[model samples]
Target: MQRQHSFDQTELGTLYLVPTPIGNLQDMTFRAVDTLKKVDLIAAEDTRNTQKLLNHFEVETKQISFHEHNTAQRIPQLVEKLLNGDSIAQVSDAGMPSISDPGKELVAACIEHDIPVVPLPGANAGLTALIASGLEPQPFYFYGFLGRKPSFQKQELTALANHQETLIFYESPHRIAKTLVNMIEIFGPQREAVLARELTKKHEEFLRGTLVELQEWATVDNVRGEFVMMVAGNDVEEVDESLVDLSPIEEVVHLIEAGESTNNAIKRVAKRRQINRQDLYKEFHEI
Candidate 1:
């Protein structure tokens, strides 16, 4: 286990994760600004946008582009700098560095190289939405973004069906309707959920309702801005072999709905019914 004493003196340079404002510039913390000013270089997801922030704070730290498209190339170079005792700060366009943003790979590389990774607390869309969501905050799961593929998204929804804790997801405006439809299918239309849009901005808004309600609301207009979606968790009893009163398909569906993987659900149901796994799989999918 690696213990990090963030302020302790060390020869190696630190990888500071600085969180910029999600929308409101006032949300940017003083420590974040100080770190931005002090770091030897800033590894930004978008240099142009970060430059605007730096200008706003009167910070003159130089920045190099480090985003998804160029992470593989940039990580090695950044690691080398860290190894050379040159401190670096990593920031995304909004919120924390690695939450649906770049910097995760670089942090992993730093850990591998024994470089200290110090994160300063600041703005985050997920936690900002969570505290106001009226949902259980302690056990919520932060699912940054879902798979773009329909089938894969469905599988992911199936896997998350039975979570007893609250669930959070980040979604773009363009795909909210489609994702809500999938959630309705898997989690049922009545499950409680919230949609927080353009958080901390002048036009920030929150929509609270059931999944089906959200599905309808998403279609009301051209949905705009990034979204933070929080949904209530699975409300169901434990599923096991003793559910003898359930039909094969029903049992399998229950297990799948309760967050059990599709393959595991099929295997368990097949074993309980003393039937071939292949036949049960076929029946489950109507294949």
Candidate 2:
């Protein structure tokens, strides 16, 4: 086990994981701004976007591009600088550096090389939306983004169907309607959910209702802005043991009877049982 004492003085320069504003510029912490000004170099997800932020804060620190695409090429160079005692600060375009964003790879590299990595807490869209969601907050699971494809997305939802903790997900505007539809199918229509959008901005709004209602709103309303979707967990205490005895085909048939399409039902059953989806499809069709 390795322990990190962020403030301990060492020959290597510290790597600060600074969080920028999610939407409102006022959300920028004083420490984050100070770190950006003080660090020898700023590694940013997007230099152009970060330059605007730096200009806003009157910080003249030089920035180097450190995004998903350039991580492989930049980590070694950043690590080398850190070893030479040139302090570095990493920031994403908004929010925390590595939560469904770039910076995890560089952080891992720093840890492997025994570099001190300090984190400055600030705005996060998921936690910001969760407190006002009117759902259980303490025991929560943060699944940032679901798969985009229907088959893969439904399979993901199926795995999370039995979770007993609040579930948080990030979704873009274009796919929110489809995601809600899939949630309705797997988690059921009656499950409580909240959708928060344009968080911390002037046009921020929260829609709270059952999954069915959210699905309806998403379908008809002009769904714009990124979304933080918080879903109430499965509260059912009793398990249906009868399902265990059903054959693969029977399980698929059961899901189909419950409103899922045959292809989706087959996929879910195949995923849950750790069997090949194509083989299950073939066997079901043969019978």
The alpha-carbon lDDT assigned to residue 199 of candidate 2 equals: 94
Model 1 residue pairs with clashes: none
Residue-wise lDDT of candidate 2 within 1-287, one digit each (tens)?
A: 99998898899999999999989999998999999999999999999999999999999999999999988999999999999999999999889989999999999999999999999999999999999999999799999999989999999999999999999999999999999999988987767899999999999999998888899999999889999999998874453587889998998999899899999988777656646678999999995
Worst 10 residues of 2 by lDDT: 234-243
| Maximum-TM-score candidate | 2
Candidate 1: tens digits of C-alpha lDDT, residues 1-287: 88778778888899999999999999988998999899999999999999999999999999999999999999999999999989999999999889999888999999998899998999999999999988888798888899999899999989998888899999999999999999988887767899999899989999998788889988997799999999988754455556768888888888888999999988876644545678888888888
In model 2, the runs with Cα more than 4 Å from the true position are 239-287
TM-score for candidate 2, residues paired by index: 0.83
In model 2, state the lDDT of residue 56.
97
Question: The CA-based lDDT of model 1 is what?
Answer: 0.89
